[model samples]
Target: MLISSSYATSPIQTYKQSETKPQNVVDEAPTSQGDTVILSKPALDLAAKEKGREFSNSFVMQVANQSNQKAEEMLAAFTYGLNNPLIDISSLNPATGNGATYTRTGQPVTDASEVLFASQNESLLKRNEILIAQEREKGTSAATILEKVMQSIDQQPQSYKDKIDWSRLSS
Candidate 1:
């Protein structure tokens, strides 16, 4: 079976196994040609990638004949970080029991990196708000209202054309 995982954006999948002769287990109904495609472990792994595997997050591969759900679920395993933050695995010794062990608990990020990133994001958002307020103060135009006005005028020509009033008589 040929299976592949591609960029984060693509759905992960296992390769469709080449048709092998099904042993003499007779079935009542005939199966579709594609139904013969067997789902294997590799395919499931690919499925894991498909789900939450950001293309930039890991080595990406491209596979076919699989759904996106499976891949993403699998990817969740890798992305799932431990909840206990005191023991940073990135710089700890697990065997010596000095480093942290995974408690399967989720931790709210208190790292300086995360804080600074969030602060920067908030800063940028504040700047954006000011820019938008200025734009609105300038009375920036929206196309939707203009479109409606044009449509109404087109549908009712008399509204724009000056109609001759016969009731006024030949003045």
Candidate 2:
């Protein structure tokens, strides 16, 4: 006697919202490491595409916010040509049943993140320069000016300190 199972399940998981919450509220948010359901190749492709789109949107908005005045035009200019990344879905492996690796173009994302840090550093430096000039105008002693600058620097997040051009403030 020979027997075979012919059931195939799509990789999509559906969740019903709890009655206590409004229809607009979700019971549980889908996280990056959430449970996985075996889905069709197309469904996987769609999911990857959606994720890429979401990431691109968020990254552009964040980068735009780093502008000197957070201008909408600056945001548009900075995000020119930035688009949803191409997500590659690797073929499923038998060793990891119903598992596939996702790979996306990362260079642009990395560069954008760097831009955010650089912008923040630039802004900090500009503010410090203004404060230093104001102190000089008030006939503040060099030692006192340096002390004030150091205080301002200390107030900044630790990560940005190394990137600031400290020598500029001294001169």
Judged by lDDT, which candidate is best?
2
Q: Number of clashing residue pairs in every model? A: 20, 3
Task: Compute the lDDT for candidate 2.
Answer: 0.37
| Collision count of model 2 | 3
All candidates: TM-score? 0.21, 0.30
Clashing pairs in 2: 10-39, 11-38, 11-39
* lDDT tens digits, residue span 1-171, model 2: 011111111110011111111113246877665666789999999989755342223322343335534333422222221112211224434464332211221122234444564566566567767886897799865444444544555456533432221211111
> What C-alpha root-mean-square deviation, in Å, does candidate 1 show against the real structure?
28.7
Give candidate 1 misplaced runs (Cα > 4 Å): 1-110, 141-171
Local lDDT at 108 for model 2: 21
